[model samples]
Each structure stands twice: as C-alpha cells, then as structure tokens.
Target: MLSVENLVVSVRRGPEIVRDVSFEIAPGEILGLVGESGSGKSMTSLALMGLLSPGIDITGGAVRLDGTDITHLQPHQRVARNCGKVAMIFQEPMTSLNPVLRIREQLEEAINVHDPRAGPERARELLDMVRIPDAGHQLNAYPHELSGGMRQRVMIAIALACRPQVLIADEPTTALDVTVQRQVLGLIRELCDSLHMGVLFITHDLGVVAQLADRVAVMYAGKLCERADVGPLFRAPLHPYTNGLLACLPDPESGNAAFETIPGAAPRPGAIPEGCPFSPRCNRAQETCRSGPVPEAHGPERQVAVCHFPVRQEAPA
Candidate 1:
C-alpha cells in the first residue's frame, strides 16, 4: 500500500539521518523497521509522513502511496491527500496527545479533520473500536487523567479516526509496562487484520517485531542493513549485524543469563564510518568490508543487506 525508494533525509547541519532506505508495505501487512536507537528509524517514519522538523529535508528519493509519488508534495498538500490515509501512533503518548484537550475533543478533532460531519457518536464508536471501556465517561477526561495505556488507546483511536489505509507506529509501545505493551500491540494487530490496513511499525524491540511483523528490515547508522521475512531472519539472518541483534536477545534455554551484546555504539550523524556503518563494531568485518559499498539486493523478495560479507547460515551442530 506504500513504497519508499532511495529515500534520503538529512538535517541542515548534520550528515544524512536516513540514507537510501527503501521498503514496501502491502495492505493488511505490517512491515517492521528494526534497529538500535539513532539508527534513523524514527527519522525515516517522520520523513515518510512529512512530519520532519524544520532544517531537515528529503534530499533524495520517492515515497509513493498506492502508486502516486508524494516525495516533494508540500506539507499541507500532502496532508490533504495523504494525512488521513497514512496515520501514525507516536512513541510517547503523553506528549503526542494534546494535554489541554479532553480525550473526546482530541478524537473528535481527528475525525473532523477527515470527515468534518462526524459527530460525537462516531468519536465514541472509534473509542469502542480500540476497546477502551466506558468510552463516554473517558471522553471528558484530559490526557493527564488517563493512564499510560489508556492514553495510547486514545492515540490509536485518533489515528484510526479517518479509517486510514496505512498506519505508521513509531515505537508505539515504548512507554508502557509489559502487560500494556502486549495489549497495545494486540489491539494494533487486530485492527489491522480487521481493517486491512497497512502498517510500518518502527521499533528497536526485536521481540515486538517478532510477534507482529511479517517482514523485518534492520537499519544501522541511517541505512538498511538487512530485510527478510520474520522466520528466515530469526532462523538464519544473513547479515552480521542482524545476527548480533538476535544474539542479544535473552535465551531462556541459556539459563536466563544476559545475552551477548553487540559491541560499540551506533555512530552519531556526522561521524558515520566510511564503509559499512556497522563495520567498526561488526565481528565479521574484514578489510574489504571497510572499503566496499553497501550490498544491494541479495535474495528473492528483494532482501537487501548492506554488508560486503553477508553471513551464511551454519550447518546444524
């Protein structure tokens, strides 16, 4: 339902935050964008939604929703055609929702933006769709009055108010406790299945992606390092970085000890390494890895890995 090609985004005084990243989401499919913090995941989401702050620009590439190129459309123009069609659930619900407005008012505003005639009843129904209890009673409550999970539900309600075709959730579960996180994610999956909505769910949490995504794209230092189906990725990740991430996940079979962690930190914007951005930290890095350009397409399904020495699956031990 949405496609991004060679999408590059950069800040005025910084190096590119997103570099030539590309992916597509089909209707009813959830494409999870996974990476470490500062890997440009959130920036990519904002760029796709035309929500980037001032001083950032779409320096290159195209964003097409259902075949129409929307890369250069003015912000207001894009909003008119694409805003409601592609909604977003931001990472932090508290700051995302208007603190001054009651839950009902915020939701009603969202509905009115797309369908001005939608009344209070329609707003309440949207709340019910998100499974929020006693929608009427919660309507008059301001953001502060609601718990973290409840506020998130309200955000979901608002994002779905327009019956959006695509939803871009940027770390939608980051602030909630484990129980609430599962609920929010389950609600999202249910809604997507029921509405046939496409979603680009951005997160650093591999566990979340493992549960929700059909396909996973791993990003590093502003570029896509690997993209694969969830099963293949978990079973036999082809990139060293992908393997590193998977290795970090705690294994119950390993006695619940802290798992192996990827070495080093994500590079800051202007300080990215010359070759593979992950080269400095990658255990498999060789001289060629530090000099060659990122790899292009490597498999069927257009699975791309930007590593000169993409990992091959090992034999069963």
Candidate 2:
C-alpha cells in the first residue's frame, strides 16, 4: 500500500499550508484527491514525488511505498533508491516533456536512467503499453506533432517505462476534451489492472472521480474535509464542502438550472480562518466550529470527516 500519514507542509518560515493530511492506496486501486484550485491537491503529489518548490517543504508526515518510508529521501536518493518504485505523470504534458526531443529520446531517457540495458526497445514497449497508435511511427514524432491526448499518452508511457509501484497522476486529463478524456482514463484503468500499480489521481472534477476513483478524498483549505468510497461519497457526502462540490455539478436530469454555487471561496494558506478554515463559508458551521479544530469521525468504510455537524443529504433541495 502507498500511505501518506499526517502529512504537513509549510512555506519557508511560513505558516502551515497542508495540515495533517493522510490517505492510502493499495496496488491496483485508484485514490482520487478532489478539490478546487489551490486546495493543495498538487502540493500533496509534489511532496510525494520529492518535487516541492524550493520555498516549500514537508514539515511532518511519512510517505511509504509498501512499508518502506521515503518521505525524507533527497531527490538524488529517490532517483537512486526508488527509481522504479515511484513515478509521476505531471498535469501538463506539453510543458513536462522536452519540446525539442522526439518521443523515442524522451522514453529512452526514462528507461535507461535506471537500467542502461533497457534502451530504445523498452521505450517502444512503453508506447505500446499506453496503447498509442502506430507506436513505431509515433516514437519519431515530436511533442508538437502529437495531439493533446497523444502527448498525454507519451507522458504516461514515460511514467510507466520505469514500472513504478506507485503512480501520481496530477490532473492528466485537464486539458483534453470529453472523448479524449475517457480514452486516457480507460488507459489508466487498464494499466492499473494489468500492472497492479497504485494510482493517486488528482482532479477537481467529482464526475471524473466517480468514473475513475474507487475511493475519493475531499480537500479544502489544505485540510482533508472528507473521504469515503466513491459510491457512499456521492450518495451521502459528509462534509459541507463535499456536498457543495457535488451540488455544483450540472445535472442533465435537472434541465440545466443554475449550477449550485458555494457562497465563499476556498481560503488561502496564509488567510485561513482562525479555526475551521471553511467556517466562513459553511452553512452548518456553528460558533464552536468557528473556533476549534473540526472533530473527525472515523468509520469502517475508511471514511474520515472533519465536521461538527456533517451534511448527510444532498446540498440542494
């Protein structure tokens, strides 16, 4: 299992930005981290990948892959010791990939980095694994030569070239249309089943989470608001934030009425409320909730929720 226990992050000499976050993903399972912009979704993935910005650092927490703690490994140590054990597919492939290099060179770089013997041939295998059409011809194509979805396939090919036990995909489908999005999601699902790689999928779309994640964690203001199996989370979201997110999705069954909107925006790390960061916007928040750490309710389904009074029903009437 991939475990993130009591993770905390802070800016250099600054206040905490990610607070006591924790979750786990077993091999072959996809754990979705869903939250709005600046909710620390990307930060959590960055921390796991040893790619946090120079000004930010993980202050407390332990990240483990199948029982081996790697939270404190320096970047070089991660490359030397955990090369194939962990890999990340970034949010934007166009920016992540080398624009000047052909797909073959890029994939070969990732493969031969850990195993020199596994060269261009292994690169071809990776492209085939991600089901890229015309793998042989595609390898010679540059990033600009491929479509957005095709570029993303190349990105996935690189991440899998190392055969990681854990894959952190940070909104890999954010730039694609619905059709291409489904193809990428399907490819990920197929890989998980075939390779048994645990995946941490980060996204803002609850609909995507429902379609792709076995379990989902809701984040807000750098705190874990709620987590549960996707079925239960959508059926009965415990936190007001989770309910609010679900409310915001346009329901075709409802004939496109104005999408429900949360009253206040998510708070920034430096501007969080004194106690519950979401208190300023939560309708069910009370005076006590406004001044204390929200009590967490833990249960059998692996559901963990921080709420004084959670919403058990849909946010809208």
Candidate 3:
C-alpha cells in the first residue's frame, strides 16, 4: 500500500544522486531493490524514510502512503504521521542500537513510543516474536553481549513494535554469518506472511533477492533500469546491468571462479553522463546509446534497459 512516484533525490550543492526512481510495495509483498555499491540503494531507502543527510533532499516526485503524499514531510514529521504506517529496519543494527542500554530497555523504548502497551512482558513478547530464545534472560544483556544475529533480531523486534504496514529492511543480514543470514531471511519472510507486511528489501545480493523478493527493481548509477517479477527476471534478465549482475553470481555446479565480478564499478553520483549512466560499461552500448535518453521497454510487469542494440532473451542461469 505504498507508492513512490518518480522520486528524485539530490545533493543540495551537487547533482541528482538518486534519479527518477519509482516502485510500489503492496500488502504482504517484498520488493527487492538491488544494485552495486554507489547505485543509490541506501540513498533511495533513506529518501523513502525522509532520512536524507543534511546536504541531500527530495528534489522531485512524491512518496505516498496508501494515498497521501508524504514526500514533503520532514524526518520528524514523517515519523509522527507515518510511524506505524511505515518503519525501517536499518542496514546495521550495531550502529542503530544503543550500546549502553539493556536489550529490554531498548525494546521498551520502541514500544513506549509507537505502542502504548509497554512493560517487561511486552518487551519479552517482542523478543519471542523474533525467535530469540530465552527472551526474558536476554532482555538484561547489553548490545555488546549479544551476538550479531541476536542484535539484528532485536532490531527487527523493535521495528515490528508498531506493526508497520511498510517495513524497509536495508540489508538486515549484511554482516551475519551465512547460517544466521539464512535464518534471518527466513524469519523476515515468515513475518511478512504472518503480519502481511509490505517490505522494501534493499540489498546488492541477488541470491538473497531470489530467496526473499516477489518482485525486483534493478538500479544502476541511481537510475532504475529494469523491473520484473523474480521468476522472469531470474529465468531471463532483460537489462544489461541485470544480466551482468546475474552472470557475476557464482555457479557451484559449473565449477566457475568463486568470484565473477562486473568489469567496472558503479559510478559515483554526479559523475554519470547525461544519457544512460550504464552505457560506458554496458556490452551492448553504442554511439547512439550516448546520444539520447535511455529507451525504456515496458511490458505487463517488466521494464528493461536503454540500449541501441538487442539484449539476450534468456540470461545465463
């Protein structure tokens, strides 16, 4: 029930950092926002939350919750108006959580702010909801005392305190071990289904997207170059950047190199050219690709990159 229309974010004294990005997150749906570093994944999430840093601002477009536009709202105002309607689970829990406070103390803070039913029991319930064992005992532990996974779980519990309609999970599994990451991903999927929470999952991990997202939005150098369902996009990616990303995934069965990286890195904001930002690195790019606006290919539920040449119908799986 959340829609971001042509949302543009820019640094006040610099160029547009996040350009014309748009998407929707329906109830019970997880829309994965994927891109390499500097592709503006985190910036887009921050823009959605009205949490842009001092120099950056939403220069264009509208972010509406259900139907009302909240793009113009200040960070504090957005929190006040859409606290329960929209909530975010930040990328790093260690930085998000208070180091000095007890786990229960932190959780109770969230409950007291968004939920009136505050107490040790309510705090315990939150911990239980996130599948943290021995919830009561862990409540007394400090952030430093908990493992990385445990701390992330605590962050999720706090985000769920308001039962938010839209949950922005910005790489919740970033630093966890693989096993813990799997558990955390599964927990997020289960919570989505059980609570019918619309989630905007931001990560550069396509493997994680394949496992968690119903739909995908591929961003390149701040521009959304493709949009499609996970199945079609995975079975056959339509954009060069999407294909590049897919091809870079390690294939255990094929005995390929452990790491297959894309040739060039994503461009820093303002360093990108006027036309398609991906042209320099795109294999199919031509002289014409740099001369005009990026071409968009739109289908029922799909959109592809701007290219003067044809793209492969089926990406290497």
Candidate 4:
C-alpha cells in the first residue's frame, strides 16, 4: 500500500500549503484526489516525490511506499529508489518527456537507471504493454512525432518500466479528448489491476473520478474536507465543498437548464482563513464556521468530513 499520514507542506518559513492531509491507496486500488485549481492537490503529489520547489518544503508527515519510509529522503535518494517503488505520471507528456530523445532512448534511460542489465527489448516491451500499436516503429520515433494520446501512452510506459509498487498520476488525461481520455483511464485501471500497484490519481474532473476512482478524497484550499468510497461520496457527499463540486456536474437525467458553480476562487497558500478556508464561499457557513477551527466528523464506513455541519444522512445497518 501507499500511505500518507498527516502530510504537511509549506513555503520556507511561510504558511502551510497542504495541511495534515492523510490517505492511503491499497494495491489494485485507485484513490482520486479532487479539488479546484490551487487547492494543493498537486503540491501534495510533489511532496510525495520529494520534488518540492526550492522555497517549498514538506514540513511534516510521512509517505510510505509498500513498507519503506520516503518522507525525508533527499531528491537524489528518492530518485534512486523511485524505479522499483514509486513512479509519477505528470500532467503534460510533451513537457514531461524529452522532446529531442527517441521513445526508445527515453525508455531505455529509465530502465537503465535502475537496471543496467536490461536492454533494448525492454523498451519495446513497455510500448506494447501500454497498448501502443506498432510498438517497434513507435519506439524509433521522437516524442513530437506522435499524437498527444500516443505521447501520454509513452509517458505511462516509462513510468511502468520498473513496475513500481505505487503510481502517482497528476492529471494524466487532462489534455486528451473524450475518446482518448476513456482509453487512457481504462488503461490505467487495467495496469493497476494487472500490476497490483496502488494509484493516487490527482485531477479536478469529477466525471473522471466517478468513472475511475475506487475512493475519493475532497480537498479545499490546503485541507482535506472529506473522504469516502466513491459511490457513497458521490451519492451523498458530506462536505459542502464536495456537494458544491458535485452540483457543478451536468445531470442528463435531471434536465437541469444550467450548471451550478462554487462561488469564489480557492484561497492561495498563506492567505487561507483561520477557521475553515472555504467558510468565505460556503453557502451554509455560520459564525462558528468562520470563528474557530473546524473539527473532523466521522460517519459510517469510515467516511470523514472536516465540517461542523456536514450533510445529514441515515446510517446503514
């Protein structure tokens, strides 16, 4: 399993950007981290990989892959162990992959980093594993020579070169079209099942979450507001922020004429409110929500919401 406990990230001697966030992804399971822009979802992922920018740092918390503690490791140290334990798929393949390098060269480089004994055959095998057709031909092509979807598949292939125990995908499908998005999502699920690798998928798309995630964790500003199984979280979201996010989804059955929107942009780090960072934009906010720290409330089946007045629902027997 990939476990993160009380993860805290902040700027150098500055305010926190990710506060006490914790979650886990079991082997063969996908945990979707959903939030609006600047909600610290990406920051949390960066902390796990020990890739935080110069001014930013992981102030507290633990990140474990399978059984190894990687929380305090330096960048080079993490990179050394990353191949067999943890790997990340970044947002844009164009930027993540080397534009000048042939697909084969890049894949070979990743494998050689951890296993020098591996050869050219391994690179071609990876392309096939990701279902990229004409693997042999594709391997010889440069990243720019392939389509956007193809480039993404190459990125996934590289990430899986060492068959990591845990995978962190940060908006991997954001740039793909609907058809390609579905294909990539299915590929991720298939790989997760086949490899039994825990996956932490970070994205703002709830539609994708509903389709891909086994569980969902809702984040706001810098804090995790709610977490629950995907079905329950979607059917009966506990946090108001989650409700607002779900409300924004278009419902073909309801025949709703307009889409709902969460008012106000998410607060930037260092500007978060003392109490609930979302209190300023929440429709149900009371004076208490804005004056004091919000306590986490527990519900059935391990559901958790950091709200004084989460949505009401009957407990399952």
lDDT of 2 at 312: 62
Tens-digit per-residue lDDT, 1-317, candidate 3: 89999999999989898899889999999999998888898999888877788999999999988788888676458557653357788777778889999988888877877777565588898899999999989999999998889999999998898678889999889888999999999999999999999999999899999999999999888888889899988877778778888999889899876786677777888789767787888888778778677677654456554455536573346
The predicted structure with the larger lDDT, 3 or 4, is: 4
lDDT of each: 0.87, 0.86, 0.84, 0.88
TM-scores of the candidates in the order shown: 0.94, 0.95, 0.93, 0.95
**Ten contiguous residues minimizing lDDT sum, candidate 3:** 299-308
TM-score computed on alpha carbons, candidate 1: 0.94
Which residues of candidate 2, in runs, are more than 4 Å off?
82-84, 298-300, 313-317
Question: Model 4 — which ten-residue stretch has the worst lDDT?
Answer: 75-84
Model 4 ranges with Cα > 4 A deviation: 79-84, 314-317
> lDDT value for candidate 4?
0.88
Positional deviation of residue 249's Cα in model 2 after best superposition, in angstroms: 1.3
Best by lDDT: 4
- How close to the true structure is residue 56 of candidate 3, measured as C-alpha lDDT? 93
* lDDT by residue (tens digit), candidate 2, 265-309: 888888888777888998988899878567887644777788888
Clashing pairs in 1: none
